[model samples]
Target: MSKLDPKLAERLRSNADGLFCAVAQQRGTGEVLMVAWMDGEALYRTLTTRKATYYSRSRQSYWVKGETSGNTQYVHEVRLDCDGDTVLLIVDQKGVACHTGTRTCFDTDILLSDSVE
Candidate 1:
């Protein structure tokens, strides 16, 4: 069981401009469910409440997954990658992971990259 790094926590708190990527994975089959970002407040909320919360750059607020849609994610474990800038959450998801009510956010492919100037 790897404990969260105190130093890493310090960096995360200090860098309010930084948003660490938080990836949610299925606990049963180890499939990646979704990817989001976590700011300090969101991280604290997730650690304390065991509910997956994330920071939305566009919304400029903390978005609680499943708060409105009933697709909540109960965190089983949170792991920091070796780089300490990304996070992985092993969670028990209720239903869809996408805001549009899809099974996962990864379901749709973004074609923007191809249209880049």
Candidate 2:
């Protein structure tokens, strides 16, 4: 049912829905672009295609980043956190990373700041 490697699959710790939190970051700049969820199949597709694919909780389906939005994320590397519950994607983003047409999902949110020091 899952195309992910057995060894790799065993290392992952997914939620009840069998999903892992995936964070996308711009390669060189180290800018976090967006956060999404990935199921085993979505991870498999991303690893195989070098494209950022995520499972949409709302849609209850898989979607490739930029499939329709023209904003794409080309994965360069993937890292699993120590807990194995989060995945970090180093990518080359071609366009906006947020659905709102922003460069990143965090751009509009500023709950805290550097001046807090």
- Model 1 TM-score relative to the real fold: 0.79
lDDT of each: 0.82, 0.94
What lDDT does model 2 reach? Answer: 0.94
Q: Per-residue lDDT of 1-117 in model 2, one digit per residue for the tens?
A: 889999999999999998999999999999999999998889999999999999999999999999998789999999999999999999999988988988999999798788854
Query: Looking at model 1, which ten-residue stretch has the lowest summed lDDT?
Result: 1-10
Cα lDDT tens digits for candidate 1, 4-103 = 4455567543245678889999899887889989876788789888999998888888888899889999999988777667889999999888787777
Q: Cα RMSD to native, each candidate?
A: 5.9, 1.4
- Each prediction's TM-score versus the true structure: 0.79, 0.95
The TM-score that candidate 2 achieves is 0.95
CA lDDT, candidate 2, residue 66 = 97
The runs of at least 3 residues in candidate 1 whose Cα sits more than 4 Å from the true structure, single-residue gaps closed, are 1-8, 11-16, 110-117
